[model samples]
Target: MLSHLPTNHHLRPLYRLLALASGVYVLVFGIIGVVQTSGAETFDRSGDATALGLPTNPAFAYASVAVGALIVLSALIGRNLDFYVYSVVGLVFQIVGMLALAFLGTDVNYFNFSVATCVVSLVIGLALFTAGLYSRVGARADAH
Candidate 1:
């Protein structure tokens, strides 16, 4: 069933670049978030902190930095390692986005995520998933 997915796709480089760009974007966002939320409570729910125009808190900002770094590292390491990294991160982003969306404006919004953040997360997740799908490498015999 998974045979339909392309391996060593012609546009793999482009997809990889997009994924890298996404990681960089997230990294920058997290850095700015950390700076913006400095001295604030780790899980502050004041709903007033924001970074790169998205709501955030210390905990979320730190997590973003870690996740972004992981993505960046995996993308740089390539050789199909990125494929697994992107796939897992993509799913994680999707799940986090949904959970944040569901908990918005409530006490459980641990990430202090706003609607914009949720949208961004979902978009990034999709981009990473697509990149992973086309970034696979196969033996010479399986090349198309």
Candidate 2:
């Protein structure tokens, strides 16, 4: 998948910027998650206002931190769409989890899953998804 990354593209900078921005966003949010609610009686699934969805708390917070780390790491190593898959995976998870949180709700924990939470997740999912897909470098016209 990393066989051929475009040498140049107008959107490359924007792509990298988005990647970095999103990466930092999640990274910081995830850190806050673990630090803020580590020993709380219940989970805390709220934050990431930058679309941000910056979700967090306890076991879930650790999960976010891991995912956030991957996102940040990918921005460093993911020079192309192939590496951007990490971002895609993380965003998709947020989208799915938030959607479920919005509708079905979690019985496993009493986290406050509200409509706003769903919106945040969905927004972040779309944002990262867009960035990942947009960054894809296609085969060159002369690569045939």
Candidate 3:
């Protein structure tokens, strides 16, 4: 699958860089969540007013940290397809979790942000997946 990619060196580097950046962002967010949860900080529940409170559960924080670390490690190892799949799954989980929180009114503002981040991550994940497909197709064509 790796051999079918096009010879365009430009796309490869761009894809790698984007993946790396996304991974780093995820890792940072995850680490922050872990720290916040470990410290037992109270998440703010105010609606778009201030982010002084913590999320309802520290479990989400821990999960975020673990997922983020996995994303970063996957990207660094050039596992683009695996990264994309994992990211999409993670984003979906986040979206559902955020929606549930919103319905429960646990923290509307925080949930809103969570939804937004999930959407953004989903888009990035889709793009990465498409890029991987393109590379695979290109590689196959080259072998013909």
Candidate 4:
């Protein structure tokens, strides 16, 4: 029972705009990640393995762009889109990223396991979870 399914609400436009912005943000970062690909580690900071000093592999760039593209698509096409689903996916990604960092922080994912990394993931996961869990859209039938 996601909100904003069938009708447009006052807040819908704002949410959609935010999604678009998020998409652009991630998309830009993704491109930057790909461009900074290098093997050697500098100050334990390897561009090939870390994007923005966050633990990442070559695949992370692609994933980020893909997520961004999805977000853009959803924002543009307002029909049959569930915002909650995307939020859940984001939440899940943060959780998985954290777990990976925890068990195999440095060696496994090549993540720095730095304070910044932990805080970033925590904030993202919490934000997504909070928004998704609290924001509810009435069923389509319930609208009219």
Query: Global CA lDDT of candidate 2, please?
Result: 0.58
lDDT of each: 0.91, 0.58, 0.50, 0.56
Compose the digit string of candidate 1's lDDT tens values, residues 1-144. Answer: 457778889899999999999999999999998999999999998878888888889999999899999999999999999999998899889998999899997898888888999999999999999998889899877875
- Could you tell me every candidate's TM-score relative to the true structure? 0.95, 0.67, 0.54, 0.63
Ranking by lDDT: 1, 2, 4, 3
Clashing pairs in 3: 4-138, 4-139, 4-140, 5-139, 42-54, 43-53, 43-54, 44-53, 44-54
Candidate 3 Cα lDDT to native: 0.50
List of clashing residue pairs for candidate 1: none
Tens digit of lDDT per residue, candidate 3, span 1-144?
445544444466566566556656655666665565454534433223212242333445555567666666665665345435444644555465546545553434443344455455566565545444432223434545
For model 4, how does the per-residue alpha-carbon lDDT over 31-83 read when each residue is reduced to its tens digit? 76666644434323353355666655446666667776776676566553536
Question: What number of clashing residue pairs does each candidate have, in the order they appear?
Answer: 0, 3, 9, 2
Off by over 4 Å in 3: 1-10, 39-57, 79-115, 134-144
Instruction: Give candidate 2 regions above 4 Å deviation.
Output: 1-8, 41-56, 81-83, 101-112, 138-144
Q: What TM-score does candidate 1 reach?
A: 0.95
Order by TM-score, highest first: 1, 2, 4, 3
Q: Compared to the true structure, candidate 4 yields what TM-score?
A: 0.63
- Scored against the true structure, residue 116 in model 3 reaches a CA lDDT of 51
| lDDT by residue (tens digit), candidate 2, 32-119 | 7667675654454443322235344465556657767777777777546424664566478566756567454555433344565556
Which sections of candidate 1 miss by over 4 Å?
Answer: none
Best by lDDT: 1
Q: Which scores better on lDDT, 2 or 4? A: 2
